[model samples]
Target: MTTFTVPPVLEARAPAEARGVARDGVRLMVSRGTAVSHHRFTDLPGLLDPGDLLVVNNSATLPAAIETIDGVRVHVSTEQPDGTWLVEPRDFDAARPGLRLRVPSGSLTLLRPFTSRLWVAAADVPGGRVEYLTRHGRPIRYSYTDRDWPISTYQNAYATVPGSAEMPSAGRPLTGAVLSALAGRGVLVAPLTLHTGVASAEVDEPPYPEWFRVPSSTASLIGHVRRSGGRVIAVGTTVVRALETGTPEGWTDVVIGPDHPIRYVDGLLTGLHEPRASHLKMLTAVAGEEALRASYESALRERYLWHEFGDVHLLLR
Candidate 1:
């Protein structure tokens, strides 16, 4: 058995805040079948065919981390079918089914435990989810982050739906100029919605159910692209989850691994992820195990960055 490991030096600590280098100035690692190459993100427009379709996640990031009177930080994962929210209790209190946290902007009450660290709860905010989060919430941060960044810093260039707790970070480096460049080359871009949940789980833990929607138009486009010999390039893993097994609108618990063969996605444009992370399993499905191993080894040897705010990797088969 092989164990994947991400070294400590590769963890990206903060968003790109450098001058003279646009956020997209990060390096790009491209793997085509068994061949690997390196380039800058600005060169992405020249890498693919004009007929290729770039499927993007239009879901935006939300300010989901909040604190309470008792100082327990609540991380909102997503909304449930019952109109309540799924959240994680940062600092465990003696909270039970009826426990309520009186926040600065509103009140959040625990309904039950969804998981060991998560709770199903309701919010009685002054206005609504958006307004409440706007007034009191901050972007969810892991221990790797130095400080809280503004919600805008976590947003994608083409974000339209405000639902995801975290950013669909693969598209973060895509500015309007890059989009125009791709368009000028006859490449097409389409949108879908996948509201990503919390990432506080262990790396190999199977992902929880997440809401996704693939419109009829996008579905038809995918079919046409396949028939016309064009590739379907997913911008992020969230997009891969949505387009692969998603219906018009529903929840997805689909976990792509090396054992499962991919059907629709041809190339993947994504941020460098942690080693041994569940996402690597999906990458193995796209690139064979040996090829994936080679790409990561090359990335490590070349000192490419890692994490949501790090460099990008393009796996094209």
Candidate 2:
């Protein structure tokens, strides 16, 4: 694996304002090997040939942000099969072992506190399930935004099935018009589900876990794309994890990196990740370390924004 140098400038995070929408809306950076290019997201259709396949994670973002009466904020991270929630709360005082949370219509009784942030709560949804509680009263918004944006704003125009706690972000730039344009150009689009858990903070916290699946149809379609000499362009890192994790043999705990060989995706369209984010490791798995570093440096010099709701980078082999 080639080791590319990370630019010092790229080490510092960009201001939130710089990460907001561009005039044309989507900001795009394209990379091929070590060379880099730039364009607006609207120029996507022109970037690919007719036969390229775009694979998107259709997992929808849920309204997982909630606020407690005491102003303690919690973000629901994951939902258990039994319906209990894995949560991360902020400014939690140990005194409150349990709390009553108000939702859209009803209230939830938090049973036990798992950690300083995590808790087990029960709620009455359409089905009887222990709902994971978070401080989010609405959808998880980016730090840059002041008010809570509607959950719809956090979703890609093609998003289906509400499951993810947050948007798969890399796919955010693909609006409805772009999807239609891609379809019109004969680029086949496919979907998979990978419910994202939580954003990876720049700390020692465990890597957020997620549940994902690639159906037989999606697997076959991916095989067909490869057989037809069409590039499989993953829309986001979430899609990358879904496709990579759901290889036919079975699911894997594989943390992607340079040592791992990509079995499915031929190209990647993703947002600029933070320094040391595990997603960057996944990119290295696909593009090699040297190329990945070069692309990141280019992105920094070119002022590509980082984090969700930031700029996007497309790497094509």
Candidate 3:
């Protein structure tokens, strides 16, 4: 995949709302073939046709980052089929098997390395997983964020099924007003559930298997939309991953890129990705190299914000 260095200035250090901008007030960059245009996220309703189906991931954000007694931050990624959890000890490199980290009312013992960056751990929390996280965990924060924000700050207004390790932030700009506007404009909206695991920022790794469910209703709606000659506009790459999996529900590790075939989606609405990020490959599959390159160049030149709390990109056929 082609890549470029992301200037530090373009990184969004705080949520738009904290920066005195409404969540839906972020910039929107549109890429169609080789042409690029810009608009505010609120103008999304006016940008699409009536018959288009906007598919959104309804997976909610998990307050997955918990601090140990020694101040080590642990990111709970997902629950494995064997009932153990996948976790990453942020900035703590000396971790090994049998290492136990104590939290507020729970303890996590690393069983083994799940990957180079994550570990398979046994979580012993008194209450349930959801209850414990609600009481003790905060949303995972990266270095780019200026300070700690509440879990609410990391959530999408439409999110309901809580499971994602991090916020599926491309949908963050989709506020109630935008939904109502899209509905009023006769644009269709559907939902799928994909519990995203920990995002790999340090490695050029392919996506890990994450549990996903495409409801029968959503599957049928997608078929109807396509047969009616309407477009399936995935609100985020997570949505594309779920839809293209072509299954009702299960763990999906499918990696999309230039060589990968895109069978279900026609367009995408997402955030600006980092250079060399695996997501760029999926974007290339949707927008093609020429348009994708053009869009990124325009985004950098226009100073569109990057990251979960940043600007958005819309790629259309």
Candidate 4:
């Protein structure tokens, strides 16, 4: 009963990289346990107190999808403990081991299947993976995304470490200006690295184990702020997972839901998740079933948009 219907038109058609909207001009929906409110993304600084800390994911988005020699496009999802990668190949006719898939600048060999659509592959980038992908790859986009956008648009302003197959989109609205304003207001902002894997935004299954790192510095800051009675807000679910798991650095497949209570994070800043998506379960853990249902109803009634380039939701409980 907590999940509500979302209109198709509510889906985000494209990121600003493919179009001409101010990248950070999206709307924001703010919610407490009992009621919901609406505001522009610019008002984020005013919503918090001086001691509040906003944690964001610094994992940069990758131009992970590439067209191979045989007209098959592969989306590199995750880098495994070994040098090989987990990839999703589209329109691939012959999917078998030792198939040398060539990119514009390099090549890859499909080793075997990791999952249904995902394959384990060995990459051969002459100029290095990052450089080659920068030249030949495009950001992995879903069907709802009408056209291709530059990989730059998929990255957060604070992005540094290049790893994520997709964007940690919840932090997209936290523009440098917004961050600067928060700093001026004495609200602390911290960073964690949670390299997200490829997801279609509608995935119902639990997320795969993605690499994440919560450095000692970030952990210490979080502890200090919490001990001082300050609110610790995670800017995205990725950050929430990284913090709750509390690993110095490791892979996490932790799936949080209503049955699983989240600790450490006080509130959340996230994109409007679709109903039945696994992300909604994470939101349910934060806002509870009844409150989340009401929030969804309010969002649909107000015509708030969804997806990476659309509006955001601020959950304060």
Candidate 5:
């Protein structure tokens, strides 16, 4: 393992609107060894050498937002494969206690206090249609914008497998032309799945459990990249999780930070996280504290936006 250093804080001072479409259109900051440069998202293909491998997370985002019986808004941000939910209600009335939600196929009652923002519920999805109904319920959206959330807005063109309560986000900037351009340049592309749960608000509770998978093919490809001395560029933190978790003997407890050592990925492309977000800790683990802090401070000074629909940062080693 490499010796890690703590970096300075990167502030996000950019307005939300500036960072919005930039999700697919933001600037990309790339670092190779000690070299750094700035470029548009369209320039991704030019940054990679022929043997570099781009690892993408194909987990689909779930429409986890739903309305309760009393019209109280509740966001089911994380869904367990076992049919339970990790819920966060907007201004939940403790006196009212339980919440009843409607899904496209059936309804579910959320039992309170599983944790601060977690709830227990039971629902039957014949042939596993939970994802389908969640989509039908409503498009999962962030509270930052007032626009009616569109499913297409939350998805990257390459997204597959419906499971995340929120967008994986890291790949949001990967447009079709960018992908084709990479292919034309001989950069290898691969996929994995790390269904992200609902993003806990900066003021919401801690992270809830989410499901993920690293296909045998993906694992093999990563190994091949490492053996050939080719960089494994993970598209987002979710991809980092999937790759790190897939390591021969590694496990995470949902906490982010420098204490964790990522074993599989060599480079990262991700969004600008809010100050104090647990996600920042994950970035620290991958980029080391010093580089992360420097990048963050630069982003803040550059006024990068924070959240899912925001600008991105790339760190390569």
Candidate 6:
């Protein structure tokens, strides 16, 4: 796996707005092959050709982090077909089967381990999970973040479907103005839904399955773009997964890496991933290992920020 040590100071502690930068003013690192260039995110529309298509994720961020009455932090990942929720209890050392944590309108009972870190638990949340979360949950935060941020700070401006535990952050920097510019520049844009699970993958672990939908309209548009010799640029890793999977609606567990064949996507716009993150493997599959490594080195040397609220990277063919 391609890896590098990210300095602690490079971690973004807050949203760009809180750091005195406009949401669209965050730094953007563009890599075409092995050459790297720096620019603000607002410059995005001009970076691509007129016929290029930008595919974005419309899955919204959820206030998935809730504190139990006993003060245990639980991150709600996904709800299974059987109606049980997959969750992560942060620092709750005594976590075990039958342990129940009380929430505002619900109680979570640990049933078994879903993964090494996640638990498949039965949650009794009244009035639906979205309604319950809106009233009682906060956005998930890690040790790197300084404090809690509002749900708005964790959402893409165009998100309409509420399901993801964390933000599909690559699209976060595309403000209303940038969208307009892309349209004016004659760049086509489309949306797909991919409700992301908690981004708490253990080192070298593959991403867990999450619900996704590639609308027939979007899939047809992709075929149209490819036939016209236009590039299909996925706005985030979620979009890549959904577009490549070609599934109309269902759970996806596909993992793209260096050896994986790239069929639908020709470019990618995304955030800087942590060292050894499986996301990096998708980056490699899209941009090649040499380009991926050189881009990360440039990002680190230039001191660009990291994490969901930080700078963005554009990898193109």
What is the lDDT of every predicted structure here?
A: 0.85, 0.71, 0.91, 0.85, 0.68, 0.91
Off by over 4 Å in 2: 1-24, 93-136, 201-206, 247-252
lDDT of residue 89 for candidate 3: 95
lDDT of 2 at 276: 53
Query: In candidate 2, what are the lDDT values of residues 214-248, reduced to their tens digit?
Result: 87887898888899999999998878777777564
Over the stretch 124-165, how does candidate 1's per-residue lDDT look in tens digits? 878766667767789998887778788898998999999888
Note each model's CA RMSD in angstroms. 1.9, 4.5, 1.2, 2.0, 4.9, 1.1
TM-score of 4: 0.93
Please provide, for model 4 over 1-317, each residue's C-alpha lDDT reduced to its tens digit, 9 standing for 90 to 100: 45466788888898743456566677888889959998888888998999999999999988988897768888888888887888888876688899888878677889998776778989887765566667788888778888777777788899999988889999997888999999999999989899988874356657878899997888999999999999999999999888888578899978888888788998999998877688888888988888888888888899988988888999987
True-vs-predicted CA distance for residue 116, candidate 6, Å: 1.0
lDDT of 3 at 228: 96
Candidate 3 lDDT over 144-205, as tens digits, reads: 88999988988888899988889999999999999999999999999999998888732587
Q: Candidate 6 has what TM-score?
A: 0.98
Runs with alpha carbons beyond 4 Å of true place in candidate 4: 1-4, 16-21
lDDT of 2: 0.71
Deviating ranges (above 4 Å) for candidate 3: none
TM-score rank order: 6, 3, 1, 4, 5, 2
> What is the per-residue lDDT of model 5 for residues 189-229, given as tens digits with 9 covering 90 to 100?
99887777666634434555556777788788888888998
Between prediction 1 and prediction 2, the one with superior TM-score is: 1
Please count the clashing residue pairs in each candidate, in the order shown.
Answer: 0, 11, 0, 0, 12, 0
Cα misplacement distance, residue 71 of candidate 1 (Å):
1.4
Model 6 per-residue lDDT tens digits across residues 89-170: 9997898999999987679999999888899999887866677777888998888999988889988979999989889999
Please give the TM-score that candidate 1 achieves against the real structure: 0.93
